[model samples]
Target: MNIAKPNSYRSGPDDRGHFGIFGGRFVAETLMPLILDLEKAYTEAKADPAFQAEMNGYLKNYVGRPSPLYFAERLTEHLGGARIYLKREELNHTGSHKVNNVLGQIMLARRMGKKRIIAETGAGQHGVATATLCARFGLECIVYMGAVDVERQQPNVIRMEMLGATVMPVQSGTRTLKDAMNEALRDWVTNVHNTFYCIGTVAGPHPYPTLVRDFQSIIGNETKAQMQEIEGRLPDSLVACIGGGSNAMGLFHPFLDDPSVEIFGVEAAGHGLTQLHAASIAGGRPGVLHGNRTYLLMDADGQIQDAHSISAGLDYPGIGPEHSWLHEVGRVNYLSATDDEALAAFQLLSKLEGIIPALEPAHAIAKVLELAPKRPRDHLMVVNLSGRGDKDVPQVGDILRGKSK
Candidate 1:
């Protein structure tokens, strides 16, 4: 099937793997053929309304699309910068933005006649979302997560289990997201004929980065419409926390062509940017993970390093290629927020804005604190409240209180 080439702004280089120097399909030989197959299918599917309609139905009925784009008046006033609003993705069904992309993949799995779903998670939100979609569609689901993440994010682990997923704890490698992803890829290669790999971010092989973006783009679509209705103009800036960068991409993709809209991605700087316990933006060097070549916190020897953050979801060694692309193109600014700052924002939003954001989104909030005061008080800024904070309370409380009593 032949479709129009990716418009100039979207495709990577011919020889260079890039989403403008951010995306390239770098993979092991074993997965290359399947990755190419997925690329063809996604190219065709993206241009087909039948495929779009089916996924759109799931977004509306299964994942609850059109999540409210809320104007956080008090939050804006408190920031003392341009007026700020929150795309309340935390209100989306399944409590975060994961369901949107998962719904699309689960549907594609059914289309491919796949009977099982396999996925990886850090905080397990993506795992839970995938499991929920499988349960809705009557497919078997399995989730692989690092043993460390399973222990740190106990609540999400329980949530995934309750949703009928078998949570497989990976014990090898640093026992975190990257390791968990490695385990999931092994499962996918082993079960390639009848299993679907539901990636959590706008990453992985060709089809994955494109497919996930198309699904989650509803976030930005709604934000644009809502902003126009209320403000009679576009937002001046956009911000989201980056784990593997799905949420950030979803919120940023629609505005990519709108150069006037400033964008920022806040990475988790666990302690401080210069400290050992951090996953700051600059901490990672450009490298390949899974199927895509992107920025990763890897050593000169090219071994992936263990990433650290109070937010397990943000504790990955790399980010999505699209995000890497955006940063390199100068369309998106990458920043960092320390653990203390994120924790403070988590509580601050709860107390001041009555919106308790997940640790990941709270990192974006921390950046907002830095950015708001620097912009005009009336400038319009939008932050993606990616998920709810209930899952983070126990761990955050322990950190605040200094060890268990």
Candidate 2:
């Protein structure tokens, strides 16, 4: 297999962590010191070869690395246009790509001499992943989740509990991911001495969006090598669902400079592009939220609007700052898939390819199905199957059963 030389995509988020005015330290004065400390620690750790080797060892033995690039022959034939490949991140130990970031963050936490870890989750995958690593590392873990998410994603909530993490349900705001994030930040501020805020996505303030993206970029780095081994060239296009945009950023970052490679980031269009969807880029305007200035779902009065989605993971009002910047520069295509469309793609993949995808990635699959038929048969397309659907089975079953009735 041949490897491509490093490209210009690495020079982003300049000295102040601003990705062309989209990202910065938009946090309280109390949190500023902690963020700066984390930035310094991460910068030092990143340059150490020992840190890289240790992270690699854990990724290999603990979290699993190089998730398969599967050629979906049946799906390809079913679509009858582009060749389809699934980057099977769902096969990871904790059942999602969320583990990839958590593993790295936990290691960083340890390096910083932090004895406790706190995080926020929407669908619960990140919470579960964080709890899993905390258990492995023998650290105290506290996860804040929205009350509505706690009720909807019970299976994952159970998994986090079973792994011995404290799960706090936040009932504030719209009772979803955004509220959970606010609660977690409050926790971080109160316990900054012994705590490390293990943010789950490529969002948050400075260094975090950049830090999480670097750790998760392992997805794209592996895909680059694996694709060259099998296809002998780069894929024509790549697709992944975006909430806070970790997995999508992981896959798209490596190919950003490759003008020949088209990238698509799918957001949830719950019912429509009206007030009831989580398509931040599609239906919202720019605003400051979660310590970053990104496109957000807000009302005319500038109050954050409630975002709805069948998929809890993609039900966010804002996206990662880098994704917001990318969308503005037109480097990547931003699209949306409705809940109904995601459900159809979820079922289609399960029946046709024996792959039950998480509803998050199902949105990308929905978009892929629409785009594939328009491209040539020889065109190669890769989609990041970010997580397994086991956590979503109960919810999906209820929906399907209702529809059947």
Candidate 3:
């Protein structure tokens, strides 16, 4: 089962849309025609400079491109190790890296003449981004969110409603992200003729993982130029939190071929990897779910297992197929952080740097706390601060007050 390695790490998902043995057009026969049509449209759009110009315009003025890469001086001093820089994606218009991808997809949907946009969300950042774009473009938007997430991410749910997007609460399965995606897919199939499904992450089938990564890759592209400007060289290491792995892939893909640069993707470990958790590559096996083959949590019987994490965004049973491929190819290191560790990291960043990071990136910061100190002071490390902590305030407050675990 040894897959030949690519000469350049960025070359991926051959014409059939696969990265090694992972990723493909795994879907219902009825959806194949639509998928093919979407792929063709994207291919054409990609080749059109005008299309890119329009997307770039929206990115700069609408979604706020070139998010700051700030030196986390206080945190670096507190840790006493590598000089750490935070890729501040939290400053984006929608308050997370999700907008970077949603903007591109929404533009494509419009180009294809789709009038309705449907999406699934876990922590609600994607939902907020989609709703914001739909509102700006005067298109109809519908978001499906797990009932549990609807309750936990109430602020974002409210924001979606404010933007005139209808939010549907999915109650099936674990009533979490996986279920929300299941419901979104069902709706997409039912309305495939007139609706466009705006996937929030680099998962799903075929072109989605590719297109989303390309859109989100802005993070890494900017980091590269910014680092060169500030440090006159590439950073020694890159770290980001992973759920469906869009943000991590966005930042890491640009550096995959840089032999001197190391990369790390941190998965939420919930209580621990030995207990209920969402560290797919660390604790799961190969399986197909949500239209792609990737590392998924399952029982001996092969039934998908529910994933748990204090942060709603990281509570998915599987990582993106690209992440699975990278893990197998040894191109990137995958690690995990427990709920308590992420919480402590969240509070520490707020206290030390005055930066309130979302729970997702806090998982990366938890690992950074240990890794940074072990590296030499001259070592350069960049961590993606993927979102703001405003949405997590209520939930974190409850947990800190012993109201919830």
Model 2 segments beyond 4 Å from truth? 1-9, 403-405
In model 3, the worst 10-residue window by lDDT is: 1-10
Worst 10 residues of 2 by lDDT: 1-10
Best by TM-score: 3
State the lDDT of candidate 3 residue by residue for 1-405, as single tens digits: 266677999999899989888998889987889999999999999999999999999989987888999999999999999999999999999999999999999999999999999999999999999999999999999999999999999999999999999999999999999999999999998999999999999999999999999999999999999999999999999999999999999999999999999999999999999999999999999898888999999999999999999999999999999999999989899999999999999999999999999999999999999899999999999999999999999999999999988
| Ten residues in sequence with the least summed lDDT for candidate 1 | 1-10
What are the clash counts of all predictions, listed in order? 5, 0, 1
Instruction: Compute the lDDT of residue 106 as modeled in candidate 3.
Output: 94
Which regions of candidate 3 deviate over 4 angstroms? Answer: 1-4
Error of 3 at 152 (Å): 0.8
Encode model 1's per-residue lDDT on 156-206: one tens digit a residue: 999888888999999999999889999999998887777888999887867
Pairs that clash in candidate 2: none
On a 0 to 100 scale, what is the lDDT of residue 372 in model 3? 100
Candidate with top lDDT is: 3
Evaluated at residue 210, the lDDT of candidate 3 is: 97
Off by over 4 Å in 1: 1-8, 11-17, 277-280
